[model samples]
Target: MKAATAVAVVVAVAVTLGMVATLAEAGDNNRVFQPCADAKIQRGDGFTFGIAFSTRESFFFNQTQLSPCDRRLSLASGANAQLALFRPKVDEISLLTVNTTSYPAVTNGGFMVAFAGRKYAARSLPAFVSNSSYTVTSFTLVLEFQKGTLQNLYWKRDGCASCSGKSNFVCLNKQECAIKTSNCKSANQGGSVDCSIGIQLAFSGTDKHDAVLNSWYEVSNLQQYSLYGLYSNLRNSLTSQYNKIF
Candidate 1:
């Protein structure tokens, strides 16, 4: 009986490793990772982008706070229900703005960058505090490409440009314009404030055609939510099956 039990354990471990290897090998094909179907995009084309949110402490990678492209890695404590994704048509230098869904409350908040492939994820950014002191609402995401393939994603600060003249805002280190969380809180104990984060998207470098790309745009005209549902469904399905193997 002991030998049989040992054999069973070994088989289980082998199966788990095999599953992980299979998933990793298939990672690039995952819709959540490559939503454009590996289509060659150019100026005037659109692609899906990802924003992963979690506690500030979880944003670190190798001691650097940057975004992670792997959804599994970006998850906080193995799961983060608060992920924002969008598809923007970037044709010219413009500002693409996106606001995340509201959270019930915040203790420590931050965000990591993610994009169309498994290879790209910028450093994470901190947005909220545990004391509810302030929240950084405005941000810029710069997409850098090398000869049409994406290479890196960067976070840019506005030096408090938008927060200027706002009574409820503050500037950190002459950059990072932040809104006071105190004003966001309601008198009710359950009131949620400073929960939303806004990000602006911009592009640089060239597409496959080597055409100079635009910088920013608004998220109003972009596609969202629907594709995310499909992504979530696929992810859940895979996870459910994997868990059952145990």
Candidate 2:
């Protein structure tokens, strides 16, 4: 009876170890995406923003698409707020260059831009991996901005000629960038000016699976602590409400 009991104990231990190994494998397959390091901004005659990310698994994938007016960041100084908009072209904007050896090739990419309340929103195209259980790491985003001209100007959401609804104009010049909105028809006129600004952006992909990804605009030469504080307050308020319900 002792020998039989010993044999049964060995069998049970083997089964338990097998189960643990399987569970660990499963856990490894579903690892979440890690955040990239905070981007560093350098200011001179122009600006450059660098972003990075990392993953453990070999079969990771990541893709980022940016559009003109897809992301906006704002800064508030007491009663005044400064907003910056990032707008990349839909077809020519290449933010991420994929490495076929390290990561699976990207399938699709593009960008779109829009004007919102006191801000311009830029959006990136969706990114995903063809296979599961892969982690993408060490992705980078580099954006270069200099002075250039933007033409064929028109109102973002309204017909330039009709001017029946709300009207706003965002103009970028050599010295400064400005947005003006007015309710009167006289203010709705559309024209192009010599904008001494040029912008270029690039990004890479990761293995995480999110259908839509958003790239926030980085505001240069502005202090945005107040904006961040307000955002933190709003997030905390929502979290508190959720906790109360749960």
Candidate 3:
């Protein structure tokens, strides 16, 4: 599988990680690193989520989702469910920039956010792109997923970010990511443009990356915790951005 798909698969596993959120965040990133490790968390704390893409015809898709966002955005197939979480501890990180160069090296808690392709490119408010200067786009966050075994983690949503290019080029820095518009294109709306939903962050750090990953099991259980955090972070990001724009 391609790197994006592999990581996207990681996002799909969030379903299982729902039960493992408590295990992953009991105290540090170290606790939730094992692939088979259980989150021991509960539903509504660390689960998956879905966001609709903008109306097709938004020109922002060109630089964001890596696809066209000019069509009838599909619904996030499994989005009916989502986890509920509060803010994450992103302020502590030295360089939380989501760039092509940095995203590959992210670790601890970066790689879990994604969106649908048929509708929005990465279908979140903060990440949406627009061509019009005044047509500022914002985020629209949904609820969080329930914590439990990832029984429903592997299915595609109705309006999921299609794996056509299977990669989103947009990246966000901790500081500017909040203000950043989801619209990558100059036009706020376009036609047949696909939404985007892919890795928000990823890392390859050692066990010492954070207070969470002290144990080897933490490293091994990557999918469980990472998936929960990914969607959780996305919802937070979108909510924050929506408040800012409105």
* 74-154: candidate 3 lDDT, tens digit per residue: 212222112112212111111011211111111111112223222212323323322222111212122112222222112
Candidate 3 has a TM-score of 0.22
lDDT of 2 by residue, 1-246 (tens): 111111111110001111211222322432211111111111111111111111111111233322222222111111111112222221122222222221112211111121111122122222221122221111112232111111112111111221123123222222122223111111122222211111223221211231111221332111211122332232232112222322
Clashes of each: 13, 31, 90
TM-score of each: 0.58, 0.16, 0.22
Clashes of 3: 90
Least accurate 10 contiguous residues by lDDT in model 3: 88-97
lDDT of 1 by residue, 9-68 (tens): 111000111121122232232233333223345665555555544565555666765444
Instruction: Please name the candidate that would achieve the greatest TM-score relative to the true structure.
Output: 1
Each prediction's RMSD to truth: 14.5, 25.8, 16.9
* Candidate lDDT (C-alpha), each: 0.43, 0.19, 0.24
Question: Which of candidates 1 and 3 reaches a greater lDDT?
Answer: 1
In terms of lDDT, model 1 sits at: 0.43
